[model samples]
Target: MAVTLADYEKVVGPEVMDEIRTLAGYVRHKSLQNINSTPVGGGVAEILTRMIPLLRELGVDATWDVIKGNEAFYAVTKAFHNALHGHPETITPKMLEVFRENTAMNLEEMKLEGDVLFIHDPQPAGLIDKKPTIGRQWIWRCHIDVSNPDPAVWEFLRPWVERYDAAVFSMPDFAREMPIPQFRIAPSIDPLSDKNRDLEPEVVRGVLERFGIDPERPVLTQISRFDRLKDPLGVIESYRMVRRHCDCQLVLAGGGADDDPEGAEVLREVEEAAAKDPDIHVLLLPPFSDLEINALVRGSTIVFQKSIREGFGLTVSEGLWKGKPVIGGAVGGIRLQIINGVTGFLIHSPEGAANRAVELLSNPELCRKLGENGQRYVRENFLITRHVKDYLLLMLALDHPGERVVRLAGI
Candidate 1:
């Protein structure tokens, strides 16, 4: 979707887009290469799908590259991901050997000749080992929440992480005490994209109908991959609790990412848990189902993100932007997005989530109030325009480290 900066004026105001253009001048004509593991599965790919085109529109020669890996490679990376979220997992010597082998293969194949190379996530983190040979500015963008990461995993990744000239994290607390400068650039949503943009009433109704859902009744939905960290089974339990208090339907929608092998297993677990419940709708949406997802959030009474350990929780922002109160876990970026009863309530368990859902379903006026607050909060803080502006600033900081001030007109 060609979402130009000019197309965002109605949602973000012309002044904001104008300021972004002014900032873009500083990094104009510079080549930036972004590398990650997947092309269409997770949030990193989703963000780059929109970002690279916008960066090019602002005169930067921006390109995105995806690393190649087999099922074994992805399985090892998935384990490392779970451990990074503080889950206890055995990191064996064989796993480290596989990770190193894959990283070396990618480094040899990837053409790293950009003025600024932005390596994202741990999958390609070991690419930093070639920094001295390439001799260019490298910024590592970590989109995971490593607040209490497994020490062994962190120590394993630390040497490669420290090799970057700078690092980018979704939250400040996710940063470690590395020697390089760390930038906190929260992931953002494209308001004009197919996922967050407005849909016709018929389109919304069609989506609900396609899923055999009733629009007149209260609907609770959570959109994320069928992963353990997302706590889909926990969401089902919470839905049951709320069902006892009120007659509402629950929709657990999302498919497995291409790089995550545990998705089918997790989906089976959720299906088994939701068996015999006619009101619970378990949808296995395929990739590029943004319009359906948009309709799901837009047509719902409320949204739930109940993650055990979250990175940035961009879905919360998407739901809030669509004017729905989101009940999320009190963790990671959820804390930044939900203001605990102001924008939305933060819950620690399924009981707390069910209680909050009861309160919201019972009070339409309060739900509207919180939804309005959340929409405005996301517009002010979490939209793609602001995220692009932050990246522009980070580019400046990387280019000139010691300067007290940066002029957007000068590189």
Candidate 2:
């Protein structure tokens, strides 16, 4: 069932509905074009899938565009992703040429239109080179932890980034000390999406059975792409640590994106790590397995996101939105989602994560309290409604530069 804006009022409160109506009214006819690397797998695509329609339904002319890139392009972009996240990497001149060539191909082929163009992440950041000709307000929405980016890669990408009218970072810490205006807008999760919606008990059971997960034991699950940064191996290690005390089953399930070339390699490593533990189930979900992901999260005794570095942990938000107590790494946007002992626990080490997971699994009341608090946290802040409203307000601010207060809608 498609979730209408009215669903948000019931979940979040009518304040969100009134805000949406008012903010949307100002930008009802304004066109928005969202360009990103893939139309599947990652959070950017997932958010856009739900967000574009909701924006259109609310009277904004929002459109989504996926930038086409070949395997070589994705390979280079993967390296860029690593470097942006402060990982040590080597980007040769050849890789630079390939990235530039691919960007040129896209620029020539893709239609550049809309009053506002939102280029998501580093993959499609170069689209702004055409801004002079496209004559639209280009906003660079970077969903990566570029707090300490590799100098070489940053230098290469910085010039292109400077071309944008404004930039958005998931957390204030993720922002680079550049001249452009930066906004700290955290990413959100849709409560009504297939990945976070309410599920029937039988549906959850069937999914668990199909994946060979035994619901008889406590289930610890982590839903994320098979990325090294997500620390799938570390999650396995943490689960092993917790398993020493609790007889719980661990399930690692996530889909790979077209832009992430290292997914298969990481999956193999994760598979090998779980080889000796029959209790550990490794499920490689295909791109469109939102409901399956939702079921796994819903059925989990404890949900975790042990990312080494993250832009903003949307999966954590998704779990929190589902009223599940989450244990996320104390980094990036995960910190913003978990209020430490209130909503969920955020830890720095695998041992800390395991200890907390065991603690949460043992105490049902604490778990319920954490989950309830998390849901309310998501309701008040991280939802597509708030994201859209922020964009609308930003658009008005951009359109009228000197206006201190752009009344988005007349109450």
Per-model lDDT:
0.90, 0.87
lDDT of 2 at 300: 90
Shift in Å, residue 254, candidate 1: 1.9
Encode model 2's per-residue lDDT on 1-411: one tens digit a residue: 777888877877787788778877887777998999998766788889888888888888999999999999998998998898888898999999999999999999999888899999998889998987868888999988899999888899999999898899888898888887888787887888787878999999998988988877889999988998899999998998998888899999988666456898999999999998899999988767889999998889889999887777788888888888999998878889999999999999999999999898889899999999998898878988788788887776677765666553354
Model 2 global lDDT (CA atoms, 0 to 1): 0.87
Worst 10 residues of 2 by lDDT: 402-411
TM-score of 1: 0.92
Q: Candidate 1's residue-wise lDDT over 1-411, tens digit each?
A: 467877887899988888788878887757889999998867888889888888888887889988889888998998999899888999999999999999989888888878888999999999888888988889999998888999989999999999899999989889889898888888899898899999999999999988999998999999988998899999999999998889999999986666556888899899999889988999999878999999999999999999988878899999999989999999889999999999999999999999999999999999999999999999999998898888887776887886777554443
Model 2: how far residue 355 lies from native, Å: 2.4
Find the candidate with the highest TM-score and give its number.
Answer: 1
**Cα TM-score of candidate 2:** 0.90
Clash count, one per candidate: 0, 0
